[model samples]
Target: MTETESKARVAKFHIGQVVKHRIFPFRGVIFDIDPVFNNTEEWWLSIPAEVRPRKDQPFYHLYAENAETEYVAYVSEQNLLADTSPEPIRHPQVREMFVRIEGGAYRPRDLRVN
Candidate 1:
């Protein structure tokens, strides 16, 4: 295996799963995933040193919301936690991209082509 492959970590979460920042006060449903960091270095460095996450782990794109408003977020797996709240996310894009399953997790809306 390649050296990069050997160091790769499996993502602990999946697209359409609801999650929250480990320290922030917001929650969202994952809409995309990157196996490793794929963003600009400036963005990575913008985070406070004590809270910054390593780039080798998975990163997620979320349609995120807090009590007052909604926005998109790019977050690292190490900085996230599964959101077990029975309440659904209020981000409008979530409905456009997913469906809530019976167990309270969101699932991607099937977009099969015939």
Candidate 2:
């Protein structure tokens, strides 16, 4: 296998899964995934060096929320943990992009027309 292939790490999460920051007070649902970091260099550098994540792991795009507000967040896989809250996510965009399944996980809206 090529060096890159050998080093590749599979994402531990999936689209529509609810997750929360490992060290932050926010939670969100995964709406997209990047197999590796794909953001600007400045954005990466802005993170404190002690806490910045490596660029080789999957990154997720989330419809995120904290106690008082909601926003979009781009988070590395290492910083996320499965959010086990029984309450559904309250981000407004979540309703537009997904539907809650029976067990509380969200699923993408089926946009294909018959």
lDDT of 1: 0.90
In model 1, the Cα lDDT at residue 110 comes to 85
How well is each residue in 1-114 modelled by candidate 1, as lDDT tens digits?
A: 866556779999998898999999999999999988889999999999999898888999999999899999999999899999999988988888899998789888887879
Number of clashing residue pairs in every model? Answer: 0, 0
**lDDT string, candidate 2, 1-114, tens digits:** 755556668999999999999999999999999988889999999999999998888999999999999999999999999999999999999999899998789999988879
State the lDDT at 87 in candidate 1.
Answer: 97
lDDT of each: 0.90, 0.94
Q: Poorest 10 consecutive residues of model 1 by lDDT?
A: 1-10
Distance from true position, residue 102, model 1, in Å?
A: 0.8
Q: Model 2 misses residue 18 by how many Å?
A: 0.2
